[model samples]
Target: GAGWPGLIEAYRDRVDIPDGARVVTLQEGNTPLVAAPHLSELTGCTVYLKVEGANPTGSFKDRGMTVAITHSLAEGSKAVICASTGNTSASAAAYAARAGLTSAVLVPQGKIALGKLAQAVVHGAKILQVQGNFDDCLELARKTAAEHPVTLVNSVNPVRLEGQKTASFEICDVLGRAPDVHCLPVGNAGNITAYWKGYTEYHGDGLVEQLPRMFGFQAAGAAPLVHGHPVAEPETVATAIRVGSPASWENAVKAKDASGGLFSAVTDEEILSAYRTLASREGVFVEPASASSVAGLLATAADGRLPTGSTVVCTVTGNGLKDPDTALAGMVEVEPLPVDPGAVASALELR
Candidate 1:
C-alpha cells in the first residue's frame, strides 16, 4: 500500500481474477525485510532476506493460495484441486479448510516432505499420491480439473501469481526503492515471474527509479532453466523443488533475459551448506530450497558477478520446519545421562 493502489487493483486488469471476489485475508503480506550481516560480509554487498517463511502457512505459498481459494469460492466452486511439490498443497489445503470447501491435492508419491503431507492430511484435503513425478501429477490434476467441477489452484490459474506479486511490493515499500538485484529459488517458476511483473509495473508507474535484476536459482538436479530443457526425472534433496518441468518456464526465461539476470543451478551440497550457514551464522533458518537463493548469491559474489555494495535481496520462501529431516541430517545424538545436575551441566557446556 506504499505509493500504490490496493493489492486487488494491481492485478484486476492484468490477471483473470474472479469478478466481485470478496477478500478474506490473514494479513499475509508485509513480511520483514531484514538485513543479513553475515550475507553482506560474505558477498561484500548489502544483503537482505525477504523472509517469506513468516507467512501464515510457514511458506510463501500462502500469499497465492489466499487469492486462488477466494476466487474459487466466489465462482461458486465448492471444491478445488492442485498438483504440488509440497508447500502449495499444504497452503491450498489449509485455505480450503478455512473457506469450508473441499480440496484435493495430487503429489508425487513419497516426494513431499513430512510436514507438508501432515498439513494436507490435517487440513482434510483429499490427498492422492500419484506414482509419478510432479509433472505427471500436474497433468493428472489439469485433466481432472477440466473434467470435473473442481477449480485448479496452481500458479497457471493467474490469481496465484497476482497474489504472489505482493511480495515484491512489500520489498519496495520497506527499502523505499528497488534493490540492485532480487534473488529467489525457482520451483514452478511462478514466483519469479510474479516478482518481475511487480518490479516492472512499479518502475513503469514511476514509483521506482529502476528495476532490479531478477536472479532465479533452481536445485542443480531439478534445474530446467540451467539445463535449457525440461528434466523428466528431476531430483533434489530440496524436496519442495524436485520439479521436472516448470509451469511458467517461458515466463521465467523472459523475466531473466528481460532483467539482464541469470538463471543457474546450485548443487544439493551447496544448498545444504547455505542452509546451515543461514541458520548458524545469519540466525535465519529456512528450508533447503530457500537456501538456493543465498547459495546463488554467494556463488555470484565469489565469481565477481555481484558488484560490491550493491543492494540485494534474497527471497527465503519457506521455513526450515517444513523439512525437519534435513535439520536432523548429520546431527549428533546425545545419549541419556544419569539424573545429575552436574552431569547435565557438563553436557550443556557449563564452566
Candidate 2:
C-alpha cells in the first residue's frame, strides 16, 4: 500500500478479479504515458507513447496475468498453462510462481527470444518446445487445459482482456479524454480488442465524448488481419507479433469495424527503423514489435490516411531488452583506445 497500488487495486470497481480471491499481483500496470515531441512535430499531431514495457515483466502481458492468475488460484487450480511467442510465457511464469502454482509454457521451438525464454526458465516454469508454430502451440495449450486441471491463462481467457482494458482507462484518465487515434501492434489481437472495450465503456459512461479510431499494425510477413486470412507460415523479425491465426480474431474484427479502425502491415525494415528511432531519438528502448505502432503512425500519416493535428497515442508493447540479439545485430566494432585521453579526444574529433 505504500507504493502505487497494482492495477486491480487501482481500478477495483472495473477490474474483475474473482470474489474471495487473494489478489495475485506483481504491482503491474500504471505505466507511463510519455510525450513524443519529435513524432508530434514530424506528423503534425500530438503524439504520446503508452510505454507498456514498464510493466513488471517488461511487457503488457503482466496486466492480464495478474487477473488471470488470481482467478486461477481462486478457482482452486493448482497449475496454469499458456502458449506464447515470448512475452506471455514470461508473464505467466512469473505470476504463477508468485501465486505458488505450477506453470507450464508451450513455446514454438527456436521462435522465442533468449531473454524472454530466460525469464520463464528462471521463474521455474516447465518449458515445452513445440515443433510447430505459435498457433499450433496455443491450440495444444487450449486442449491440454480443457482436459487437465490446469487453467489456461492465455488471452483466450475473458478475464485476461478484462484486466487489459484498464489500459484504456489509464489513457483516458491521463489525457482527460480519448485520443483521436490509438495505434498499436496487433499480434494475437487481444490488446486491440481490450482497448476498444475499455474506450467504449468509458464513452458509454459519459467519461469521454468520443472514442478513438484504432490503428492496428502487423508485421508484413505475418499480417493475417490485414490479409483477412490466416497465414500458414507467419515469419517476421518482430517475433512478438508473428501470429497468423490470432485467437481473438472475431473480437478484433468487431473492434476494427465498430471503432472505424484500420489494420495495416509494415515491413521489417520499417519496424527496425522505428525501433531505432524510438531508442536513439525518443530515449525509449522498446522491442522491434513494440515499434510497429510508430511504424503504422508514420505510414498512415505519409499516405494521408491519418489526419494531421490530431491527438494520437501509440502503444509500445515491450522493452528492447527482451531481444538483445536484434539490437546488437550488425553492430560495428570500434577500435579500442590505447588508454590515452588524447586518443579519445581525437576519436571524438575534439583535438
lDDT of each: 0.89, 0.95
After TM-score superposition, what is the CA distance of residue 272 in candidate 2 from its true location, in Å?
A: 0.5
Candidate of highest lDDT: 2
Candidate 1 vs. true structure, TM-score: 0.95
Residues 230-308 of candidate 2 have per-residue lDDT tens digits of: 9999999999999999999999989988889899999999999999999998999999999999999999999999999
> What is the Cα-based lDDT of residue 146 in candidate 2?
90
Off by over 4 Å in 2: none
lDDT of 1 by residue, 119-164 (tens): 9999999999999999998999999999999999999998898889
> Looking at model 1, which ten-residue stretch has the lowest summed lDDT?
1-10
Stretches of candidate 1 above 4 Å error? 1-19, 349-351
